[model samples]
Target: MAEPGDTSVLATAKAKSQKSHELASCVIKEPLFSYAHLQVLNGNPLQEPIELDALQVRSYCTAALQQFLGIAGTAISIDILKVDGSDCWLRVPRDSLGAFSAAITAWRGTNENGVHTTFRVKGCSDWLGSLVGQVGQDTLWSK
Candidate 1:
């Protein structure tokens, strides 16, 4: 049996407690990227469905950035993660999320073939999983 004043047992207990605490707490230091879920919309409800390709997505984003922030804004890197129908997923630098979002929001949509199209930012998150979960919820509620 251990004595009440046993320093070795006390140190062992302290070490085990510290390890458990460390395991329970997680600190994500400076996440490198942020994610956004966007949907394309057209002004006319009677128009055909919009199908976005990678090139079109990039062009639209570039135009918005250039319009909002000029050359500097155009320099912001945007990664197209996935494109499905009218919806797209994008990854951008964590530092530029605000500027990117603002650019998309403020720009007037482009008109092509009498169809006016614009991007709507459905959601944004530093963690992609959160944005993905939100998308799932949106689908659930939408149906």
Candidate 2:
């Protein structure tokens, strides 16, 4: 059995929602650029920090992709946004984000001392501004 009051309330709510949607303009959404912020971690966290430059980071990423994804991995284009100590920021095509992240996560990184290391994804986003905001927050709250 349906209550008369309940049916009227439901009808009113639906009418309002439909009217709201009808008033909105049509807008097309385009794909956004994907970015990943990563931290380099050594096999032994307590050991000396691993220093990496832009070139080293690029090679490391390529090697990781090659190790995990093989020949197909080489096709991925990566742009190194910034590199500071063991932390680095990178950009990849939006469509290739999944493969890039997967390859990096699956591969184990090694250092000059024969110690193993890996890149850890700290944050990923399509908007660079939001990513930079996070960095600011970290600095503000850390002190």
Per-model TM-score, in order, reads: 0.82, 0.71
Looking at model 1, the pairs that clash are none
lDDT for model 2, please: 0.84
For model 2, residues 25-126, the per-residue Cα lDDT tens digits are 765364556889888898886788888899988988999889988999988999999999988999999888888999988887776667878898778887
Question: Which ten contiguous residues of candidate 1 have the minimum total lDDT?
Answer: 17-26
lDDT of 1 by residue, 1-143 (tens): 99999999999988877843434766898899999999899999887769999999999999999999999999999999999999999999999999999999997989998889999999999999889888767578678
lDDT of 1: 0.92
* lDDT of the candidates, in the order given: 0.92, 0.84
Q: Cα deviation in Å at residue 32, candidate 1?
A: 1.7
What is the total number of backbone clashes in candidate 1?
0
Clashing pairs in 2: 109-117
Instruction: Candidate 1: give its CA RMSD in angstroms.
Output: 3.3
Q: Assess candidate 1 and give its TM-score to the true structure.
A: 0.82
- CA deviation > 4 Å runs, candidate 2: 1-28, 136-143
